[model samples]
Target chain A: MKSTYLALILVLASAPLWARTTPEELAEHPRWKALLHINQGTTWRYQGRSYIDDPDFFLHESGATDARAELEASIEQLRSSESEARCDFPARYRFLSQQLDWPDDGALSHCSEYQEWRGAMPEERVALIFPASYLNSPSSMFGHTLLRIDHGEDEDGVWLSRAINFGATVQGQENSILYVYRGLFGGYPGYFSNVPYMNKIRDYAHLENRDMWEYQLNLDEQEREWLLAHLWELEDIEFDYLFLDENCSFRLLELINLARPESGLMNDFRLAEVPANTVSSLDRAGFIESVDYRPSKANELDALVKQLDATEQDLALALAADHAVTEREAFRELEPRRQNLVARTAYAHLRLQNREGERSQAAAERGMALLRTINGTPTVSGIEPERPVSPEKGHGTKMLAAGGGMLGDRGFGELQARFSYHDWLDNPDGYLNGAAIEAFNARIRRTEGDDLTLEQLDVVNIKSLAPRNSFRKPVSWFVNGGLDRRFIGEKRHLTRHIQGGPGLAWELGPVMPYAYAMARAENNSAHEVLVSTAAGARAGVLWYADGFQLGLEAEGLYYHNDDRRYRPSATLNVPLGRNHALRARIERDGGPDRAETEFHLSWRYYFD
Target chain B: MRKTLLAAALVATSFGAQASAPGGSGCGWGNMLFEGNDGMPMHVLATLVNGTSGNRTFGITSGTNGCDTSGALSYHGENMLAQAGVMEEVAQDMAVGDGEALTALSVSMGIPAEERDHFKKTMHENFSTIFPSEDVTAEEVMANIQKVMNQDKQLASLS
Candidate 1:
């Protein structure tokens, strides 16, 4: 048998890598990247060495009245689920056979027979043999280190696989001819990606997988859109994924961002549209509870007026009086999802105004969010509320209950704020640039200094921040004035006006040292309409300095107006001290033109 | 019998012509070192003709100039000469080498490793960088290690 294999190897080794696909490559075929890793489970880690092996900790965490009962129940459920799910490998090897090959001690002989039977066919002279050790859930890591390779080779050339990333060298027995199946990348069902970056590949897969037909099922695009109508339903419903189990917590978030790649439109009604529709339909069908999120504007207005009367002038400030602008910016970026927290507080007051015994309405539209009242107090969770996860009720908290993410929120925000910066080293024409309005923000707070400041766990005075922002520019160079409704925690409020306008976007070029053009015609008095066109391209080696961002956007925007409006903006984001960002830009905003001649220099703390 | 031998020789000669084509012999073969570690017997895998030596027969654990890449030889017998002592034992019984060159070769040639982390930390990144053929990898060109293990001490296992 060994000699037969050796003879076969010699013939295969001598086989000139056929121009056509080889047997091994064809074995992997279109779905070669989909070998499941039958290991990497949480239970394996929980048993000992990696984490808490203490029985006390396990008992405390499980929260089950009876630990043994919980374990038995869990096992039963897993087996049931396993039975319900489709068996990945063919059925011939489902039961152990009498005699076969290496590793398998007289098991899966039928599998070998099957391989022989399949190999007998003339069209394709190959069979994908399933080693017996892998027959039981080949998706897990312990099941098998399986792979398919391109077996084409001339004595001169050989073909290899590029899917697997090995943790360490193989034991010389099996070649590193494959990529491992750690988990899903993007939203691809039962598949992994070979993309270079771990997260980047996951993100790309996420964005592309959103539109898969598997996600649609019998529902048309309109039904999907209908389900997305409610904010909660839109955010909560995941059609394509029959199982909510994503690659990992970190990967899930990265995939979410990937799915929502175009960050400029975060609250994009696209996904929300269908998810909301489903929630409404499901609620009507009595599957999920019909949440009450709608609250009256009158209730909010009344509460504001009463707070104004009740508070002494100094008593009302956004958070504590000791907090600085930097602190507020810190809070805004740190707790962006605090929008729900504030909404919950507002609903508390709205609930009081409701008629006796009548249910109060919900104010926020995101149906995916849940609101719970604790001793007449209310709060909200962004993705999933961290209430006691009632398995019987079929609910749980978010994977990222604590998004203690963002290495440097403040720094990241600042770097992001310089959003629309271009270095004219490359393209000189059609280019679009603008800082996302996530930069426009406020930190709301309330004060109770003279009162018995929470005597329990509460301190004499405390501060908390909540983020608020919204603004988009269309065909620029127009004055846009708006108002800021600031809040000091649960009480004091303030509103202010904002005014600014004028914006332009041009298409950059394929022409080397390209000269791009831009045209403007908004004759509104609130805005200025001056045809300003300037294109001078300089050649500088464009490359990224630190991290993955390419520092290659440089060009002089020379407006032909009386004063040459040169917005020569170039900012280099130097991740200096722990995301302690240092940015510098040089722009001749008004050089021999009537455009505003001001060198804009602004610096602020990023994440607190 | 003479005609059959001639026909076979003619067919083999035609292989040379085909080898010269794109994705042919020139792109095959990644750099392989005579790994001397633990109980591993140093065996020559292939002889690279960097300089001419008239193809004189050489024994295992023996080489005049083929081991030295800088030397000008016509044939490298049974192994791609490598800078010695490059492969090192990291910890207890654990060996690690800058096998990127081998890795790129393996990946490009479709020779997956039996032990994933065994010969990792590849230095040769681009499979196409060293060789012209897109079809070759270190796995295919690598001499069967078992053959190397079982061969006569005098004769190299592969070349």
Candidate 2:
């Protein structure tokens, strides 16, 4: 009788262990934690809390903080036929059923809403769609990333594929300043949205004139299904949108990581996230199976225009400007093929012009006429834009440089660190050429027998040198605001300044030369005036190649206090490899009272 | 049997929602082509924020809400190319006689692989009829495409 009682007790104790997954164990599971978006206490303030900002996402009262209790409550709710947990959290139900070996009671099978939604999307493949940077758009300047859920085997079917995007929700009438301020400080709520891929293409390629790169992932069938299921759970869920770290690219990475937990794509990015850097991370993680490029409409137009001769180009431009040009002798004399090319170019130009602002009725009519003319002729060979190097092949966004150089008369050892993004002299392989966007760039120098001093701190500096041709005339512009060491009278003082202007750039052979008429405001400590404003003009020539870049620039500024300053600089950058480069600069600073010449040579290392 | 019935009911409800008003009144033919343009400040703001102003779609339903279900060209519940921006691309591609947009439209229309070239050719030939005017609605364009497809022996079955 005693032995029987002991055996019975042993069976009861072991039964609890073998029969089901403990709430504690299920709470700590990687997949469960991922579904809940629970951070592993890595982020300082958000440790052990869910990343989801919305309270509705959690089932239990303490669900956001206490995973074990949430799991227990969720299991109870899922098992109860009276509750809507199975329908509301289908992914959780599916996961729990597998883990707990629950009976096939058709509980989840009866989740009609989820079943119908799942039935609609029979996706078997996924690709990461990255729209390259558009300098005209401040938010897109860092580039943007989204996912495309592909169905069927047809290559053309990609246009119909569903795109999953995460972005901030903003009021329609928000001004640009408020938009930037809210985007930077996480004042807006970000949500996941699924739209047709073609809409995204229209927005990125046709409207914004940005090229897109598609990185088809190598996820298997089961993994793809899990991603889709998780995506459903995230429907209508909100997250705090922080531009630096928890932005669009970061959210997409989270989704990809949840799909294949082993990918661990989110482990490295801690401080800030840039869209291009995420592509490099995915490539490093071996998630990319293949890469494809889709050129923008502007690129297509450029290619079409290139195929025409100088005279034909002029005719094409004239035809686009005025549909009446088609009746002219110069247009009438062209061969059928040349006429088709010109007509096609004209149509593309009209479409691009109509993309922004109010569409002129005349432009629309011309577009239709051109299309009709093109349709009447035999179809020529299509134009394919030349693909540049992939974004992953470019140098990393964060840069560190170490060197020593002569500042005025003293020898100084300088350390420069740019928090994010490329400059004109940086390797331009994977980035936009003639465009420079740098944020939080800081330089420190220690002169002979002197303490280390902050040389310069640039909060934001953006330069877009869009070279103009006969076909399209884009204005080149630059804006820079920062603190820099400048000579006020005879002493070097750190001054805060903001300067910007609009200019024009033209490409001549291998070089692009630009000139800008600039306005500036400065707060200088050594200056007699508390705040000094200036009017200035700058001219620069940039010659860039695959492995080397050289720039010569000069500027003259006349301050409100009648002090005049001139600066001329020559910079050369030679990229040794993808991530290493040697840069040298010789600059002369001419002030009202004195002039100083300085030289700097540095080896730069690029990293994410 | 019960699960299937429930699934049917759910699908019916979703379809009902879609049929009633998918994209609300804001999704009209007039707003389709020039939808993104909303004056200089809004345009500049959109460029800077990259946010979809007042767009709150969870992607549960079909992504497109511009399809006119009342039209005869409604195939498979939603017309994939009904969005104005995509319609514009389709019109352009149809004019070219061959392009990605045209091929995508053919695929969406359920045209077989072998019949796609014939469909493209037919659409190319009928570009003027399909896009009668720049202000033509997506429903009209889709109807014209269907009519053109029906006339072609190879693509009639797809229509």
Candidate 3:
């Protein structure tokens, strides 16, 4: 009887050790859900299954959709020595081992490849890098975001740090139209790449002339390790690239959220992920540790030119144009400091010109000579470029406005909504000067006793007014296409039209005046043909001050069918705060058959 | 005057041809520098749709994308500046005896902060030798830099 009692006690004592963790329990873990990128939304659905689009990323057949199955398969695969699971999914292995009391049997130590890669890139710190908007490039018009991994500064500093970039793996030599189509519709596979930080600086600051902002992250060491482990597991993984939402910035936020689940970096960025808005979100979430700005080559040259007088600027320009100008009295009469400045400016100009054109022997020789002259003189202290307002300080990307306005003899209440971006009359605190980009802007009006009618719907509108200066003469241009209600004789009809052209703009202090000779193609109900084209001209003056904006514009169009139209408009915007504004606009539209006058005052609110 | 200019051009072309073909080490630095020069259409299109030209490296090798791991001018077993296109910037910075590119190069060479000014001064004085011509390759520039640094007491220890 005593032996039987002892046997029962022994059986009871070993019961807890034999109890195994169920797949359901492991699958329900928060870390497991994060590893699978399982977010609570219909937008993240892929193939009517899970968020991950890549089949290779899953270990089980239904791993993409079935978390419990994936966990079971992962556990089984991890136990086998011949399987690639340990190396292929190190982050999963690390998590599983920590959660379950796995024996220290050298399972992780066998992952030589993962060990080597992890050892090579010891991530002690991370920084979110934002290459600011370059309006000239369509892809960069919204800016770009990436991550830089710093292994605590050695003698080499962070210049050799590794930069993690996620972008579409675009196919070969596609045309612009096809490229845009593929980019918008997820026809391309996006992947994460690791590159040296210096290469990025060279590409952005030197070649593309885009300034970069680096925001150091405050992730703890444990969080950084978790992030790096997940990053390694994503090697060669592909994600469907959607230009608007599932883009580079969005994927970066996913990685960040995986590191600190409580951070919720991806929560409020479901609809649209503007790069600047993401930066603002990071700032709000307290992920930003510090901020640093690196100026572009153009900014550097501009700063240098600002130090010189008008005659000296002319001299520098001459030296850049003609190498023989260096021997002239005008050049030799300057002090050594001034001479150094002129030579530096000339060299920068030559470099910039060479970047845009084929290499010329004469220009190269001139550049070499200028460098020699610069080296012979005593080195001057470098001048720092003026820093503009940071992107996060700008008003949000989406806007909504409500107001009452008069159109001809009718008074109406109008509600306007813009899906994205900045416009000329919007606050220009953090946006590029003289630049405007809007997409999917819609206005609906309700007449005093009538039903609501769509007034206008703009699919895309973009404008860049780069002003001409003594040092740089950039061409200004605008393009817009949309549906608008136009006066056709005595009735208003919806017309589809696209207009664009190139022009020149000059900056007079805070006021910029621009003019464009435009051509338009439209499908109007009143047109004699299905599609009618028109030639027109547009002139505008924009004045930006403290927190206020004013724009005066006029346009004239002559259609192919002998229809003439003239329009003049003025808009004034006053900011109540960063996200609130009051705008007033007045316009007179005159056609060959009829004329109408309209005015409106609106209160606008902006959000991300 | 036109004849003299033509003669100088011919001489430069011949010199360029004779001087050890820029990227003889198979690092393709010259090609990298001239990468986006395929006219405005492609440049505008590529930059418009995708921010990058889609040349990606999955970290299979130690040096991920542009750098050639087998190159002579390597740091931590990976070439730091082989295909970065920063050679021109570095040359300009070297001429001025101070700039961001100069500092980056010094750091890549493992020069300590206290010795960076000396390194920059050394490179500044040797700018002509480092960049003898516009067609000078990154390998040649690196070789020249190492030669000059080897001659300097403070920088020699770091290099």
Candidate 4:
């Protein structure tokens, strides 16, 4: 009996050698295509091999290219030996087995460290956190996205949970200009990092004063486990960061696609992935369960200030000021609740003031003393503002405008469009109010003589109109550049123009008034001088109501070569619906000739 | 005149005891050197970082940057970060007597929701002692809180 059993074991062991697979046969399998696709492997015909985008994600020698060959080799290796640290084998193994109808042998095994990490990872829930657009920083203008892995109880544990952040690990110090250049042109290598959610909250909510929105993913336990495992597989993997395409938003979408391949989150986002666009895509995939908002310090203070009476607000300011004896005395004379209100308001006011370097050290100390004086006072002023609409709720970022009107004595047909982003009067419901950012805005005109001309091409235009308040004195600003059609006497000529300036803006009831001292430089194509620099002043007032917005501006410019001009403009924006608007603009230019007037009426549509 | 004499005697004896004791010191220069008394250096460092970290008191109030009560517990057991942060919020919402600052303070102190009203009342009544002047430190604020707690049986029991 022993001799017979030995003979049978030898025969069984030799059976797998009889039908070994060729590389060609392995490559033909559908399972191989799926596996290679998930690894982000592409055939480099010139190099005559395949390579994976993330080198660290796969362990097999041919894992980067020739997915079938790698799979067949890995399966053979796994069957032969144990304890190999093929970190990504388990998922591939399971996928191949189920797709190819292979036997359920426990051949694929994880290393001890990988197993330990898997056990330690959260299995219940996942959340996508987006810190909204921070216009102050060039990098975060499109906003940023990260994933939070919930390990404990739902609500409260979110604060202490771990997060996965993918960012470009800049090698050394770079100034803001260099940083932007490097970021846009793939000058930095991006890497994924794991950090606690508290760190992000610190950076966004308090330090940056940007609100955060958390969208809990509707992934089940199995999906969450798969995502967690894949995240671990991607640990320390490096990818060249391209600001436009392979950016934070794009990479996160790719990661999601790995876990839920059927959703194909990365399918339509091959070219560019705006943060809000990616968020909308996730919603479309039916992955988002619910959303939670965490207000920034600025938002909280704004809400709190709205609730305070004028006298209480004054007392609050006085308490924050170092030398306001009269206000302090008046504050003390108030009732207990009022006193607490004044103190709380003062404390909040000082905190915001300190951000702009407006508060002195002594005044700050007094602010703390005022708080301690009213400690435990039961003033229930938890005035959280109603949450803003989600970015997905806003109209699509791209805009198309079409209409026609007259330019001086000529009748013309006009078409204008912008590739991205919001404008101040474009139904500021789901966007940052009073903020406008436009990229690649172009306008083309057709004259009555059937001549098509490019009127303007704006490379970038960003305007931030932050209104001043009692607590914050922010300097609003504008920056714009590109080719513009300026009327030189009677004919229109395209000029290369770059202009920006710092300005002050104040909100008075429904009208916001602003003034700016601008330095403008332009190179007119049909001018005697190649470049002309001008020092100009512009003042404008914007009156806005429910669905109506009207703006009026007057500007006077003095060029370096004793050329002087004055331009006055007015724009009226009326909302047609949620995603459409009608606008009428009129401008008068006074130069060597009499003032020339250009009027236009256009209809604008915002997409989804 | 009699009271002044007693105060002088008390000061003299206290100074003599501090001078002769082994490793005993005042809070000033000694605290900076070896932290022999008051741990004033650590408190000062905490205060300076808290004020200069570009977050201001709002960072602490919002529980960002680890600016919570657990961190920077001064020698007198006062959470300086919390004290500075809560003051701002308390001053903002004083009329209602309830705000994020007070809520955070209560949560950190393990005060039950039912006892918050009493806690607020005690602090409001003892405000004069807690903040006797505009230059009061977090330690003085905490010490005054303890004194207030001792005088109120409900607060003392809760603490």
Candidate 5:
């Protein structure tokens, strides 16, 4: 299962088909598809509204989801309608006055005619409720099972999810909802006790994407980069997103590229105290603020809750006095509210009392504040925006150079050996560019047994636009493959093959859909043939906007391999440099064996 | 809208049967489990039907139908007792015109006094409350139940 999943990841990752078939598959996943298709042929902007329809709550914070504002207006309408309801619906209104409680069980199975399409959806249709549910069923946390529905018959349907997870990105997909948050993978779990029914619900979601990669999120600095590269290598497989459950917060920050973007790193410690700053011991003050929040004894909410609790108690007593109730009777009515106030006071008091005592609260709070100082904030001191805290002082590579290989073009073989080095730019946007080859090399094992030896530097190009703010610059890509027929001993029998191509690259957003198209040539030394062409294309979106790149290419070959059985095939028609891209690839020759199905995965690097 | 109305009609026609609930003190497993007038009993599978689109969908409604203790449930006399309890509750709650009580008694399955209460509560809450009736005699309730279940086709206008 694991291997099959790995193979699937490699295959699906490489296929550039973000735009493909639907209509039929639409029936199966109507909700999510509906959200996408709703504003088709529309750009990122429609009128003044954003064209990006990720029904998640991000837009809700801005109060943008209510396009018509009917709900907003309903609140005002309620006041005036009360008079008419009292006059004409005395009895009808009475039922609603206390909110008639029906048998919860009876209602679950039987929805009234009043419910519309998004009715008691559990039975109507299976809804893919996102971030609302992580792993366990709501029964554990909430008493009953919660199934999200946008519309329903008797119940207020039209809501998105029935069951939800905490702090999840519950997007309202047209056909189904999906969570895109950090620590959510695995699959939705049903309630612990609901057994058979809950089990059935789990079975319905069908989360058997056997190829998902699992890793602990709490890795140290070196291991963090180490794992990210591994994640990048296995990018060929399809997955919703990576969930850095344990250390996602910091792990994600470390992956940021400050150089290409901002082109500098904040003095992680006190800038003045930096080892190189020996001047005044890098003013610890400069960094102390980064890890600390300006703390005050009394917070705004703490003061407010205290005052409100007292005020409410007094009001309750006054109300009782006005009605002439027993002191004890009135106190009961006012008690819970007062208790609620007390709870708030206790919470705030603890926050203030727990300041900087023996516990590390003071230190942790200071640390958090310090992070905010340097996070996304421009400099407060005289530091240049592009200045690095340590600069490239400790950053240099000892390249493991590779000896040149021979490439036989048509009739003759050519050999060339060269040296090249790549640097690790802390910008995530450059994760796919040809600049960060150094970082890539540190992660995966492209070569077996021994540490990978970098041979001749055939090509490297890494460009940056706003690297931080603006994501418009197009980074070019280049690839070179060469064959070593001799001297390599064990690899002697294999003909040397080398090919290089360079093209433009662009990322739609940070860790988002990325693309690069380049033209290049390939040659085999032992076979004595050089095939060249500009008709190759590779493209696919990175999953969850992560650094994983997926692409597919169909190229017309310059020279075909003569393995008698395994014919290396590429797809294209225009003999060589047609304006058309590397078209739909076809496996024309399945080697000497008439028919075969196969997929390939290659590790990559970017040197900026 | 159409689905909701259709679903409502099915609810109306099913003629829910409820049994009176026996008293509450340290009730045994069966008593505590079956006390649910609103939800499914622990062992008793509740077949909830939510028919929208007016499609009267009949999902496998497997249970001790008729409460006859046959099929896989034949071993337990609970079904038979439950059925009789239901009939007794109806007869007791809706005692009819003078001589009618005797006739109902003849047809009654003879449930115990204790079990009768369970039927009454079940009937009241398991949704027998849908067709509201005030001061309905014993024979009338029995007759109505029979007619709904297709055992008796006769209908008597209130006098």
Candidate 6:
């Protein structure tokens, strides 16, 4: 009896220490380190109290605190609770349970709702949803990324898969300027929201005309379960929204990294994260298994129109127009095959137009009638274009170019660098055709015996020319605001310029020609030096086949200060490899005082 | 306006008794956007809304279609593509009657609140003729709607 009492006392003494770990030992735990590394407990001042954006994720204490205390407290709670507690992250518990070799009791079975969701979303197959960049929308200019939990549904159920999306929840209505400012800074709180994949299709494919690319990931069931579990943990959790770094793509990468810690997808992105870059990282990590493309309504219509002859195209246009009876008569005259094509094309055209009320109603009814008439025969066929190389297969986002050539008789060495994104003149292979968006692009040149001069510094420049085709006619536009050096007298003067306008473009066979009328203003130390403004017109024609490209552009600038100038330029680009290209350019500038010509040859390298 | 009312009258006449039958359809005007077949008016409306409203239309439209809910009915346990097929069939004629397959679909293709009863009445009246049996398929429903339209003088004249 005396020995038994002593042994009981010894067992009781060690039980408390086993249940509650020391802060230092808890700090060494891998799960603890993972949570801290992800900024799980990072606190920010909001209103007055310190707020930890991740709601109920850390249960040791409210607000931001030490991870050690949280882990120790969690273990204590776990030991005392009869059932699995609701306060801890299920993934974390699973990790800790394995790390510490805890018993296989039902203590961690609290998350029935989440378990049900997980069962519905089979972890065997997963896909990454990338809504390719739509330059027209400011928010989508950088593109967006989401994760799809594919449950292996049938063809129709494929769209029923659940999607994990992280986006900023705008707190209140604000003006455009304020909204932009808030979006850039941390004024909004970003959160993870789950929805069916079909909704995203409707938004991007049908409404916004942005194509979606699905890249199925090659993760094992274990890795996929980890991803789903972490995503479930992130549900309804808020994170400070920073447009540059902690945006949608960045958060998605972090989530992916949590699943495969050694993959280190987040490490490559330090300051900025682009959706395409993350995709490239996933590819590099050997996560991508296969790729599929879902063409937008506009894409299909564009492709279909190319197959039609001029007469068939005109018939399609008539069917899409408001004259219902005439269009019907014209539609019926075509052969069955032609009729089917025209009816489908007309329907797509009308939908793209998106009219309203009774007139649209009648045209829709009429379009349906045409389709119904053809349904008895055979349906129109949809011929899909060969999917372009995946965005991951494209050249990297960061570009560096170095070359030396004669500039107006002066031998100068020019170095150009672009921090992020694509330019039209660049190889248009893994990007949207006729679309360009660049940030922090600069060109510096040093004369043979002179100091380096900043020839151009563009903060942001975006241009989208969705060429007008028979089926759809969308406005083509360009907006460029930056600083440039203009040759004034004998030297160059730095001038700030803002220019933008809308125009039209058409694709004729292998060549696409475009024109834009723009209002441009340049302030060169306005109060001290030359101040000039111009309403200008620019025309360009581009011919591209395979990987070779040649472009010719002419611009006539009518200045308010009588510095009227006309500039014509031609460019030839040849691709050297997947990530390298050589570009040659020659330009002639004609102004009131004199006429000068310049030439440049540059070798460009891209890095992702 | 006269032409539109006539079309509506023709639809009403055909669908009057069986509008609320199982799998009965609605006006299906909203799908003009979904099917990429909007008329001039719908196209104009879509353009106006797409320009100014951002994704509000997505919220409105998807929510109307039961996309906002987790337990959305599948096309007889079929996948998304099959559900889309059914939607296309329903778009052919919104005025049809109730059936087991269309319960989920009708919720998705919600008519204007005020027009629900009239739309339902139209579907109830046309249900038996459209279905003819309990196991009627979407393709059958579409073919039947096409037949009804073919038989109507006003609709046939326009076609």
Candidates' DockQ values?
0.01, 0.24, 0.12, 0.04, 0.02, 0.06
Show model 2 residue runs off by greater than 4 Å. Answer: A1-20, A41-45, A81-83, A175-177, B1-78
- At residue A83, what lDDT does model 1 achieve? 33
lDDT of 4 at A564: 68
Query: Which tens-of-lDDT digit does each residue in A499-532 have in candidate 6?
Result: 8888898887668899999988888753244557
Candidate 4 runs further than 4 Å off: A1-54, A73-81, A87-110, A118-120, A323-327, A354-364, B1-159
Expressed as tens digits, the lDDT of each residue in A55-109 for candidate 5 is: 3211133323333231122222222332321222222222122122212322212
Best candidate, TM-score: 2
Per-residue lDDT of model 2, residues A1-608, tens digit only = 53344345334433544346567766766667778888764343367788886776788888888888778888888876545767767778766776776777876676666777677664878999988877444446678888998876687778767778887655444565666687777677777766667667766777667899999999888778778888777766778777877778877888887776656665542687788988988999899999999998888988898898999888888888888888899988988778899999887776766665445667777777888889887668857888988888899999999998997889999999999899988888998878899999999999998988999999999898888877778888889999988777787788899999999998775699999999999998777777899999999999986569999999999998888889999999999899999999999986889889999999999987
TM-score of chain B of each: 0.19, 0.58, 0.56, 0.47, 0.22, 0.28
Ranking by DockQ: 2, 3, 6, 4, 5, 1
Best by lDDT: 2
- Which regions of candidate 5 fall more than 4 Å away from where they truly are? A1-506, A511-517, A530-535, A543-608, B1-159
| Per-prediction TM-score | 0.24, 0.89, 0.87, 0.75, 0.18, 0.78
lDDT of 1 by residue, B1-159 (tens): 112321222211110001111111111111111122111111111112211011111100011111212211101211221212111101100111222223433333233454223323221111112222212232332333223323423223211
- Residue runs of model 6 more than 4 Å from their true location after superposition: A1-52, A62-65, A79-84, A108-110, A119-122, A153-156, A322-333, A355-360, A380-382, A526-531, B1-30, B33-159
**Model 2 lDDT, full chain set:** 0.74
Q: Model 4, range A288-337, lDDT digits (tens) per residue?
A: 99999888877877777777788777666766675354345676587877
- Of the native A-B interface contacts, what share survives in model 6? 0.05
The list of candidate 1 runs beyond 4 A from truth reads: A1-86, A89-534, A538-563, A567-576, A584-588, A591-608, B1-155
Candidate with best DockQ: 2
